[model samples]
Target chain A: MRAGKGLKWVTLLRRVADTQDTDAFAALFEHFAPRVKAFLIKSGADHAMAEECAQDVMVTVWRKAGQFDASRASVATWIFTIARNRRIDMLRRDRRPEPEDLNWGPEEEPDQLDILSLQQESDQLVAAIAELPEKQRVMIERAYFGELSHSEIADETGLPLGTIKSRIRLALERLRHSLS
Target chain B: MITHHLSDKLLMAYSTGTLPEAFNLAVATHIAMCDECRARLASFDAVGGAVLEEVSEPSVTMRADALSATLARVKAQPPVQRKVAVPPKDDVIPAPLRDYLGADGEIRWRSLGGGAKQMVLETSEHATARLLFIPAGTAVPDHTHGGLELTLVLQGAFADEHDRFGRGDVEIADEETHHQPVAEMGEDCICLAVTDAPLKFRGLIPRLAQPFLGI
Candidate 1:
């Protein structure tokens, strides 16, 4: 069923890429737009800004659909990256002096062994996150979802800056170990 | 090969898109040269995907016309023409830096004496980025940071109290770090440095020149 669902998304993306099909886009919008909005809100964007950013992210996904490589990243991962970048762009709108450069360029093709290992690691990510201790999980959530800097997290949590950095570092070490 | 690398926390912040633009530039430039860091970043991106999957759906719903409106906009707009980045023939500068350098493709360096020169890159108000060129075996004045400083070696290597930094390596220094960085003998060291505030130079000459340098 998981494999089937992944294939479905791949097909939908292909349809949008090949034909610029609105129907395919609509399906994607229905599934991802609300999630993107929620993700933005979790990152401290107000509701209005989150809604607008979500709309922009979907538009970008539509325009850049042709550039998506299913072999390199899953559809969900790709869409999540778009949403994250769009939120950052929104925050940087007035402050940034230069145009947003979103091009990551072509990633080097992975060897078969690398691809297999990465796939296995990707599959374990969710479980690894679940296994994190409560304090570590909270730190990760604040850093990733809340979009708080170390200092900001320190301020909010009333923890020393050094403590925040050390805890987050430990959590990342565990995640890296499990993923590797 | 890079002996030093960006900390995992920095890479995680970068992958999650939480870094300010200056830090983002440093990370992107370093990732351009280091394949290992790029692959590690991909894993962090996968973690972001997992975290997104677990975020419970919000109670707020989109406007009823959101999807239709998006489709209409998509139909109205022409397909975007993406400019494929040409890899630089000169290995000295990578593609990410090239995007910022623009047409002239040359840096106008301001000499800082002692065979060191710098060219500042315009960025956001929160941080400053500059390209520093230090001749081989020369030492930068001993100083500590007022805020965070992230430096990526683009050409030769440098050594400080912490460790040796080679091509594609990133050195993150904070207010607590105070050391003089010396370029390794071989080639002039070229680095992309981003800092939130000016350095606190210990020497009278460097301290006097700091204001004029705009670092």
Candidate 2:
């Protein structure tokens, strides 16, 4: 069940990639489409547009499943990139440039150990962010959600992230003590 | 080896899909040549992934037919996107940069005087993307940025008040930076320079329309 619980989305992607298995694709959609739609909505798309784009993103997910490499990214991270790119295309008139493919041939098979560590790291990263003080967490979320202007992002981040993280912690602790 | 790299803020912006198209192109080209930035970018991407994973289930659900509809579309579309035709690879220019230059990576450069030349790549209105060629020992004009500047060295190298930027290196300058960059001795320098605002030329009359680097 540990294996089953740890984003078996990775394994499911393999099935979808190898056999065009609709079952695996359905499972992925069931888990991610709503989140993708919400992400779009939060990023300022109207409901109708977000709904339509979510489907489009999921379809692209299935289409590009063959290119997914588990060693480098968790399934959620991979899907997030697809959703983000689709959002960019929806919002921007200009073409977005993407980094070149790592190589021309087939995506090399990810090592089993590498895949496990990546998934673990992804899980831990999510938990760590979840634990951030509201002020700190909101800033990050705002940055990712496009709530902050480019200048605001640039100016606010003048301090190193580690410095800001500690500042937020100290400020939050002081507030907590005052309340207590 | 790449000595300079993109800022964390810029990388996060790239991961978040908030950067202007020109900046995106510059960052993409840099990541193609630099693995350290590539790894940093992947970790930043993981944050987005985590956001998607732990996000509260939305109040709204996927339309009932969303899956079925997607499957039907899948039947119509091939499992893989048709490969974009691969142009012959340039030994120096990276793939994403090549994609924008289009067809053999040929560039037509306009003189910027002082043996420095530039070709502005067409990008969205939010920013300007240009390629600069400086003969060895040539000096680009002194300028300060109105907003932000990101320059990635593609061939040879250049040095300014800050440091030497070599192939795969990126130099990020903002409003406060004021300096002149001279192509290093030996090979000539070729770089992709992007700016979010007009470059304020120091002590030069502004050209009619070329607001960047007093072209």
Candidate 3:
């Protein structure tokens, strides 16, 4: 079943690249659209804008399927990279998105949150994170992975901004030390 | 003083993309020449990737027409290029010194006794912006920042605090930080610097070097 599923996606991608097949496109959309929406929403996007951007991303994927190269990147990575680039561009506009702008304040770092890893590079990073002090690990995750601003963290955890900053600094230092 | 060297905290904040835009810009410029920090940044990227994978997969069935829609769009778009075009060489202004200075800023880069040269990336507008580039085999007069100053080694290595940095090594400095950077035994050393205010020379020779050094 797993192999079949994998084959299905690979075929779907290949066909999407070669023939621009709509049925294949629809299938891909159905699988990824919601996830994309969730990603934007979780990253501080407003509900409406997130939905709009998610649709835009899916449409771009459809149009750009011919650009996909399986050897260099997995379908997920390609899509995620696209999403990230788009998000960065959107953030660079003259007017900023109010909902997406999180403030940076000080707060105590949280405990380590569970991390998911699919790629080997990500796995190495997870191991690196595991080596960090719990305080540093938690702050890093909450600030970066969770998309929470330092200020938000301070407000949420009631920690001083300086303390929060120090924890993150110490955490990065440890992570860098371990990785090195 | 812990030398706010931005604390590892600020560095961590930067790696995680939570830093303020201005601070991020400062650090980004620093990182462009600092390798030790870049490796740490890579690790933070990994942590972010791990978190992304943990999100539960969406449970939904593919609609019959989804593939056709995507395919139709693909037919209309062009192929992606293998690589983005490289920025023009002149546009790739080296960092550190380039950060606070405008692209068209006027300044003089004069060679000192050895290969060391000082060019004021930023003029006398403020007390804090200065940078000195030392070529290979050059020696810089020891000095300290009147404010916050950051040095980023863009090419080759220089030694001061008994540590060596190749390309992309960044050293942050302030009033309390004083070090004389001597270029490695081989190869020219080019460094980009950002200073808050300017330098305060403690010795006569160092004072004489400041104007030419543009410290």
Interface RMSD of each: 7.5, 10.1, 11.0
Per-residue CA lDDT of model 3 for A22-116, tens digit only, reads 67767777666666666566666666676667667877876666555332223554565555545555554111111110111122111222011
Top model number, DockQ: 2
Off by over 4 Å in 2: A1-7, A154-180, B81-90, B102-104, B204-215
lDDT of each: 0.70, 0.76, 0.50
- The per-residue C-alpha lDDT of model 3 at residue A180 equals 35
User: TM-score of B chain for each model?
Assistant: 0.87, 0.88, 0.55
Reference-based lDDT, residue A89, model 2: 79
Root-mean-square deviation (CA) per prediction: 6.9, 8.9, 12.0
Order the candidates by TM-score, highest first — what do you get?
2, 1, 3
Q: Which regions of candidate 1 are displaced past 4 Å?
A: A1-7, A21-23, A93-123, A150-180, B78-90
Error of 1 at A157 (Å): 17
Interface RMSD of 3: 11.0
Q: How accurate is candidate 3 locally (lDDT)?
A: 0.50
What lDDT tens digits, residue by residue, belong to model 2 across residues A110-151? 456656655666666777788877877778777777676556
TM-score for each predicted model, relative to the true structure: 0.79, 0.87, 0.52
